[model samples]
Target: MSRSALKLRSWPLTILYYLLPFAALRPLARVGWRPTSRVAIYKSVPTRLLSRAWGRLNQVELPTWLRKPVYSLYIWTFGVNMKEAAVEDLHQYRNLSEFFRRKLKPQARPVCDSHCVISPADGKILHFGRVKNCEVEQVKGVTYSLESFLGPQTWTENLPISKTSFQDQLVTKEGNELYHCVIYLAPGDYHCFHSPTDWKVFHRRHFPGSLMSVNPGVARWIKELFCYNERVVLTGGWQHGFFSLTAVGATNVGSIRIYFDRDLQTNSPRYSKGSHNDMSYVTNNNQDGIVMRKGEQLGEFNLGSTIVLIFEAPKDFTFNLKAGQKIHFGEAVGSL
Candidate 1:
């Protein structure tokens, strides 16, 4: 192609690029666009398949000579601190999963014994407070229904059916209220999660849905973002009342593994959207269900994910965390 002809063709393209931004600034209504429309488009993305592919890619064994360069690049890009890791040698990790699931030094994250509740994993505190109207805030102002996120309370029976809302039903005792905390894990954060408090897990609800990005930035813009993502909700009782911990899957996290639940699987090939599969830990032999002590390892994700804690606590319960604060596992989250 001639130089003059190439410049002539590129001139119009350059003008179009500058004009596109101005056109986009106009009222989206005039262009038949709404922000909510993005939900549908986001849903259309095959994140499950993409995540599965990423999972496979992560498992590819690296050549011994190339491990340091490859892993160091990732460490540098994500700002991963090797000093905190149990294995400081970058070449020691054979695959990405090994590095992501790396154990921290024993003295690195000391669980706070003073508080009633501690953070479940290493991440940033997205939101935390009382759950009012059965709605828990995903971020500052974005909320998702407590029932929708936890699924129907089908396991609990014998309670008198009344006109009381789902949120009200959760509070078994007077002066007790439901509280929630949302923690978002970045790619550089630890992948394993621990039990935030001493609670008995009676039920597990697995909802297979979209593998959307649970990034704080995305959560702020997308309503009910957590509700649509694949999640495992472990529900039970603590000293106060109903308690539940949910692990939310993200775009590239292909798996959510509960160390205790051997049969539980996530990101399955076939699923019925909007319908959840439930597992009852209360069985004939075991009446109390699975017991989780404070700081006990619970589950892990393939990569970074999100953990949502919704439990019953006294009305006087207060949080030690602040919005957008970087937190580590075993750090104090709240106390009564």
Candidate 2:
């Protein structure tokens, strides 16, 4: 589709998304509403089947006429600038999806310094600042608690102290580093996710939920959208603290797959506690931790999606950013 036509098409869909009953949709999600929710007949089967098929097809080598145009459309939709990307040759890609999530040229995004927090991907920074107490500001007059986003066990274990005041200095000396940045990936933006800091990925978890649209408007109107969305959470070990990177899934965005381990596939089943009795068993046994250098590709979100970064308490670093700022891969997000 042409750029103008695509923009025109997105307007009504955007309107419908805002008009929908978001709170009521939460229950349906808890009961298993997902991208495949539309296929009523195959609803009994695992949704992974559909995503697997799509993933396999995306990997199939195809002709340039077919691949290039599809990728061009994706770039146009996401407003991706070819000049900034490492790989600009559209004909070199194997498929539309491959082109959509193409890797950057080595020099395209250079890691700032060993101690710097590098941007995880090439996209626009939705928001970034200190986490005052347990709350994170999504917009003016809108805030969501970090405790609520990370679930009870993880939240309680990670954040033991309560944040009583927002103005009482962002990061205290008590080891709680108050900082987070949310990056939104448009269809044309590079979909690959990278490590923001040098760390060992010790644990990974997938939460099964609905595939709601995560556009800016939807984010403002839909409370707890990021926390409730189907997402893959990756926890990493840093020198003085721990950090998490959440790859949130969106509508028609089949899956979020991490390349940390070759064994983990996008179509794999959700192994959270509620779904399986031995939830910890699976994750613990498969804890073949991998070390990732800053800017190293960790995962990729199929189609387009969002990535949320969480820092442990008493965070020492402060982000040099603001809302709606565009960030490129390998750029310094903050200093330790």
Candidate 3:
């Protein structure tokens, strides 16, 4: 079918989906088109069903002849270059996630070995700069609390703020300045994310919230896009300072699989049973924690999502990235 024809046929589903769900949230008349309000409606619907459907469809085993057309269409639409993927053949991927998380050959991306930090994923750098006064830039005229995004304030039951601040352990700077960076993965980009620096992850927090679209369109307009989404926060420290990597989820991106913590599961039905205000947490206080080298695989987004990194480095540290710059995994984006 022609692309235009395919697009035409898809509207009925969209129409049905939008109208039927309004009945569940009664008196939907109050909801406005404002991004956050719209997102409240978006999260109200059980989109996990759609996520399951997509997952099941991707995992279906297909005959070689049947696979070609599907794979070809995806490649053509996404502009995926087969040369960079570790398994170049389309038939090698059993499911879409396999293709999404395809590994790269060793030489395809060389890990930066200098006294620096690297890009953690292959995507566009949304924003990267200093974290000032516990706020980080989300977009122009938009910012979110760095501490709240990292979950110290939100995890009231699990973590308490005493005399010592969490940032104190990670950052040893003079002015209490911490660095922040956000990278967004699109549908066509590589889904796997890596560690930006050599660090030991001591704790992780999973905050369950609305699975709204993190696409630039929604993000630019939505308040606290990262803070409002379902996300997994990894907290740890490196030689110079403390860092936290937050993996934010989106609609239809049901799973955020952490290889290090196999027990971690996102978008689960239990969490969505009654409220989205629940949280899951884990800590490694007894042990030293999981040590990862720069460019090591941290986790993956089953579908495209966003990653937020907040850290405080020693003096003379600088990021080599600009807003909206497209970056590849293992490429150096900052130097100490």
Instruction: Return the top candidate by TM-score.
Output: 1
Work out the TM-score per prediction: 0.89, 0.71, 0.81
Candidate 2 — which pairs collide? 86-105, 175-313, 175-314, 176-313, 176-314, 176-315, 177-313, 177-314, 177-315
Give the per-residue lDDT digits (tens) of candidate 3, residues 172-235: 5454457888898876678889988888777778876657667776677667878877888887
- Prediction 2 global C-alpha lDDT: 0.63
- Cα lDDT of model 2 by residue, 1-336, tens digit: 778887665544332222232333445557777734522322233434444455666778887677667666555545667876667887888875666576766777777785467788877788887766677755544677675555433321333346554323223346555577888876667778888888766666666655666766557755666665577777655665667787877654656777745544443545352231102212445553677788777888776678888765444566767678878777878775
Q: How close is candidate 2 to the true structure, as a TM-score?
A: 0.71
Error of 1 at 263 (Å): 0.4
What are the Cα lDDT values of the candidates? 0.84, 0.63, 0.71
Residues 49-152, model 1: lDDT tens digits: 87777778879998888889877766655667889999998889898778888998999889999998999999999999999988999999899988899877
In terms of TM-score, how similar is model 1 to the real structure? 0.89
Those runs of model 1 whose alpha carbons end farther than 4 Å from true positions after fitting are 1-33, 158-163
Q: For model 1, state the Cα shift of residue 49 in Å.
A: 0.8
Model 1 / residue 26 / CA error / Å: 14
Candidate 2, superposed: residue stretches over 4 Å from native: 1-64, 83-87, 154-175, 262-288, 313-316
Report the C-alpha displacement of residue 193, candidate 3, in angstroms. Answer: 1.2
Please rank every candidate by lDDT, starting with the best.
1, 3, 2
Q: Model 3, 19: alpha-carbon shift in Å?
A: 15
